[model samples]
Target chain A: MKIKKVVELLNAKVVSGHDHLEAEVEFCFASDLMSDVLTVETENLLLLTGLANLQTIRTSEMSDISKIIFVRKKNATEEMIRLAAENEMILIECDYSMFKTSGILFSAGLKPVY
Target chain B: MMHFEFHVEGGNFLKAGAASSQLKKILKQLNVDPKTIKRVVVAMYEAEVNIVAHAYKGDIYIDIDTKKIEITLIDEGPGIPDIDLAMKQGFSTASSVVREMGFGAGMGLPNIKNNSDELTITSEVNKGTTVKFATYLNQ
Candidate 1:
């Protein structure tokens, strides 16, 4: 799924990335633990996370995940957003809970990489 | 196998993940397959977190080769009392502060085990912990 559709599906606000919203995402994984995301293969995936920490961006970078949709209305700090943007990751903030955001993205045709 | 070592700053959350992040970057530059890089990074990242979250003093050493990538993490923190108990997925002794950092959730070892082809952890009471992980290449 293209990132633009994902933003609209969840009524997300683009926190730092909009120019690259046209990026294509191939998979999704929702987890608050950076450990889960690190252990799992989430390449080209759109990560659904509520935890807004610099480590979140680092986790996504480790797995080559470029699209991070922060659910539960959580937003990344300015430094986190800048770091993600510097890495060319498309960061989004959504009001929907993690479960609902996952459902919406799934129904919109985004699946897990595994 | 040829060896490359990387250092991680202690108690710095902003710099906590640098070891694994650099490993991923170097692997990519070497043209290693994406999946292999993913596995290596996963294993390394978990170890890196462990170092920051626990040891309070340590370093990460990475050895990369054709068949596999080997990562060795050595930390001087008080060693684990029971390696078996520590291996459990939800087992953690992390302070509340570490938890707020979104780590210390007890998934570090299991996640490393899940991502690596093989994992070996050795620790001595009051000494430290040494974790060795291997991620085999398939492509």
Candidate 2:
């Protein structure tokens, strides 16, 4: 699904990387654990995480994950936004919990990384 | 051949992956294969986080060449007493603060082992630890 559609489906706010809205993503991984996030090796992936910190951005950078949705209304700090922007990652913030966000995206045709 | 050194301040969450990030950039500029670069970065980042989440101070030594990349991380802090136990997935000695930061689920070393072609660890309790790993570029 295109990230723009995901934004509309989850009512998510784009925190950074607006230029990537049109990007198509096939896989989504939801986790609060940055360690688990690093173990994933999928392309065109989206990360739905509640952990809003610099490490989250760092994890995404290492994993080559380009899109992130901060679930449970978690707000990305200024440092995180700056880092994500530098990594060219698209950061999204949503009020829904991780589970809910994952369900919505999965229902909307986002495949899991498993 | 190229060698680089980076210092890691223990318990400094914000700067945890700086060294790994820099290495990744250098590998990219060197036109290393993407898969090889990912393995190197993931292994290095996990090891880097281990230092930040547990050690008092650490240093990362990196050597890159046409055949492979070798990394050695030495830290001055409480060393692991049980290497076998520490290698278990989900075994962690990190504080609650580190756990809250989405780490400390005990996967760092295992992840490094999974990504590296060669791995070795040595430590002395209450003193320090050393982790060395290598990733072959041609793999």
Candidate 3:
């Protein structure tokens, strides 16, 4: 799925990298654990999580994850958003719970990178 | 061979990941294969976090070779009382502050082991700990 498709499907607010909406996503990894993200993830995979911190952004950076969907209405910190922008990643904020978002996106053809 | 060193300061949450971040940069500059680089970064990052989260202090020494990459993490801290249990995914001794920083999920060592080709750990109670990790260079 294209990243923009996820944005539209979730009705999420794009926090950064509005220009990369057309980027392709081969997989989506839903996790609140940075270890799992660092170990199992691949580039271009969308990360869905409720944990909002600079480490979330840092984890995305290390894994070259270009798209992040913040679930459960959790907001990313200002530093997190700024880092995401610097890292050229698309950050999204959504009100959907992680389980629901995963279901919605999974039903929309998103699969875990694991 | 390329050599690198990183200091792990105890109780410094903000600098916990500095070592792994720098190692990633170094690997990128050397044009190491992305797969190999990720192995090194993830493993080393786990070491860095362990130091800050559990130990008094640590120093990571790296030896990058064409055949293999080696990393050694030495720390003076409260040693692991049970190595077997600590290696489990859900085991953690991290404080709340570390958890608030998005880590301490108790997956660091397992992640390190999963990413590296070889790993060895040694610790002494009331003394310190050392972890050695190695990954083969792709032929």
Question: Which candidate, 1 or 3, would have the higher lDDT against the true structure?
Answer: 3
Q: Which candidate tops TM-score?
A: 2
Native contacts recovered by candidate 3, as a share? Answer: 0.47
Residues B1-139 of candidate 2: C-alpha lDDT, one tens digit per residue: 9999999999999898899899989999999989889999999999999999999999999999889899999999999999999999989988999988899998999999999999999999999999999999876
- List chain A TM-scores, every candidate, in order: 0.94, 0.97, 0.94
For this target, which candidate reaches the highest DockQ against the unseen true structure?
Answer: 2
Among all windows of 10 consecutive residues in model 3 chain B, the one with the lowest summed lDDT is B13-22
**What RMSD does each model have against the real structure?**
2.2, 0.7, 1.9
Pairs that clash in candidate 1: none
What is the C-alpha lDDT profile of model 1 across A10-110, one tens digit per residue?
88899887898888887888988776677665457778998988999988887788888888888889889888887788888899999999888888888
Q: Report the C-alpha lDDT of model 3 over B17-89, residue by residue, as the tens digit.
A: 7678788888888899987887778788778878888899999999998988999999999998888898998
Candidate No. with top lDDT: 2
Q: Which 10-residue window of candidate 2 chain B scores lowest in summed lDDT?
A: B11-20
- Label model 3 with its docking quality class: medium
Error of 1 at B118 (Å): 3.2
Selected candidate, larger lDDT, 1 vs 2: 2
